[model samples]
Target: MTGTATLLHHDGTEEIPRFLGAPGAALFGCLHRPAGVARSLVVLCSSIGAEWKYNYRREVLLARRLAERGVAAVRFHYLGSGNSDDGSPDFAALVAQARQVEAWGRAESGATRVGYFGARFGALVAAAASADTDMPLTAWGAPGTGAGYFRELLRIERVGRLAEGSAAFAEAEEPRVRLARGEPADVVGYPLPPELYDSAQSLVFTELAGTAPRDVCLVEIGGDGSARRAAESLTERGLRVHASRLVEDRSWWLHDADWRPDETRQTVRNMIEETVDWFLTVLPT
Candidate 1:
């Protein structure tokens, strides 16, 4: 609800940057409008912390590619993350924000059909938000449960400490204790609020309410099979699920100094191509 300027791309698509939601809780986003009429709209939800930073370029590319194919896409930063407002939002709040973004994208583009495409932790948000809405969803490299993802953060912190010559493995639970004590802890340079930590521990994809959706496309990067069981669970619940795996380096987890975009060029291209193709088949024309 704040931006007013529109940036026109060479492809005749326009990128409109704006803030949505209430004044203090406004979320920053960019709307990629196609050259002419749009057939569908996609809300692109990003991962938190370093994943968000590393995948930022790919999300922009995905939006632009969708626009080129006559589809409108909206990419946004969750409240308290990225360019959005400064209030710490828990996992549930992030899910609500995703729903709000999808609604706003539909209204703003006048596109009757909408879909969600989320990466990493954002995949959890998309799955939770798509509940009962019957929208198509695509999750890339999603964890099976929030608790697992939270533990990974702690592992990363421990590794960092070890690399810095600090014997902190024995105190690996310090961050969890801090959160349990109603305090904030820093994880991989991002502040993790106690409320968010608590909510994350309770978020289980297989047990989420209203798990039904139009369909789901699960793309696993690095062939780790982390999302395989979750995809199978959705299938068991009678949801249409298509799952695939791609072997690639885990560039999303790398530090800025260690990340090299060229190495993952093929992976990014394949992901966007597959996502756009899948959306075309699942969403109403």
Candidate 2:
């Protein structure tokens, strides 16, 4: 199913909301189509929890910008997130979902070439989904390991409880204990199941199997060296990688109550411009 097209700009770029996959198990997505025929399509994978909410607007702008540059882009939510169906998907299931979206984007956009763009946790998903395929990839602020990312989520939950003047330590430990008992844990509002948590804990990018993409761009936001290390590791595996560092505020961590207009604008612009430029460079003619 699809929603009415909303004109994004006078340049003939439009955003169409869509529901892909089987009925009742559909994944929610927005397809941004360019004015003319697009030879390429970039699928935007999103991080979960609060990070997904924070990056929503930026991703919308990124999709619009890609469409404006004659590249179709689709941003979608996996199962149990956003407007999609409700179900806890494990890490491998998440990767499968991304691959499904990539195929759907290509068929829906009629783009001969397809690529992936993901930030934070989504970066890991994108990389895993693109394995054994020739699809180009752009990953920003990807965590080195799933265990670390899961721990960070727990930390966020703890910090949030502390800010509320509650028993932060106990609340934080509760989730780990629940997961240990083979149950789902509510980590920062996301109900993470034990299977997903265990799979995520073993996810290490450098240890991913299969062939890597020929073209890759690893972006580091706020001078974090993680992206550089990821790029180096991927390079050692025979992937051609471009590492870029952006000096901008961490807008994804900022809440609406702490919104800073100028800083947010700059961050969005830098991210969009860098991504669009890189996409255009590697996009097949």
Candidate 3:
């Protein structure tokens, strides 16, 4: 096994199947427990979109690293996506999933301190899940709110089809149309669950600020130029925010992969590493 692969194996390993509390069925995944079960557990939620495919392996690798560092970690798919129980992908269920992960991580590992690492929609879900649950966030490219995130999606489609003129928006099948209708619409073949869309639009950061965390909430940005720029508004509430980028990862929803991904992963690796380091520094000893 490679050095990276060794971190996954632990002497007291326990398999908590379906432990992450995915709302539906496809949420089945494992929680790897290493020695320091009493420390902190990192629950990871993935970005919901095509970008998921690009970083799936990298996410697993980072989770494995967390296991090696003595923090038992749980990585699972949200409802409607991943292997978890598939459905129309309800946002509420997905948020609850993160809570379930935090709940289970504390219970199974005997750890009181829990941290969440969420990407894209997963990051939003993590934020919601952590609310009132007392978990701090280490989010990567989490959208400002459900509405902002939704707008970014439309921006991509709009920019891509601009040459098609306003005619693109004229079609009944257009994303903007489906969004207005509040139904599941395919975005490059990936189903955009309506419950997710409307619910996201219904939320704001203030509503998301449920339980206050200790101090800093670590945030990572993708190399999606305009998108990352927009993500900065997350810092508005005076949260001690650290901004960084994952170069190898591009905006997954864009019609054309307009980014250099290898550079993006470097940013992700640094973000994960620093997140762990910060966790060690800030988390009470």
Estimated TM-score for each candidate: 0.91, 0.90, 0.75
* Cα lDDT tens digits for candidate 1, 50-138: 77877788889888888888889999898878889987788989888888887778887878888888888888888787777678888
Q: Please state the error at residue 138 of candidate 3 in Å.
A: 0.8
Per-candidate clash tally: 1, 0, 16
Give the TM-score comparing model 3 with the true structure, all chains together: 0.75
Among all windows of 10 consecutive residues in model 1, the one with the lowest summed lDDT is 249-258
Best-fitting candidate, measured by TM-score? 1
Segments in model 1 whose C-alpha atoms lie over 4 Å from true places: 167-173, 256-258, 262-264
Task: Sum up the clashes in candidate 3.
Answer: 16
Rank order (by TM-score, best first): 1, 2, 3
User: Model 3, range 147-219, lDDT digits (tens) per residue?
Assistant: 8877877666566566567776555377766767876777644778877787777776434643453344535
Ranking by lDDT: 1, 2, 3
lDDT for each residue of candidate 2 in 1-285, tens digit (9 for 90 to 100)? 645556566888777787887777888888898988989999898887778877777788888889989999998998988999887888899898888877777887889998888877888888788778778888877777889988988887877777866665554567888999999888767677887888898888655522654788887776668877877877888888888877754455446566765335776688789889999999963
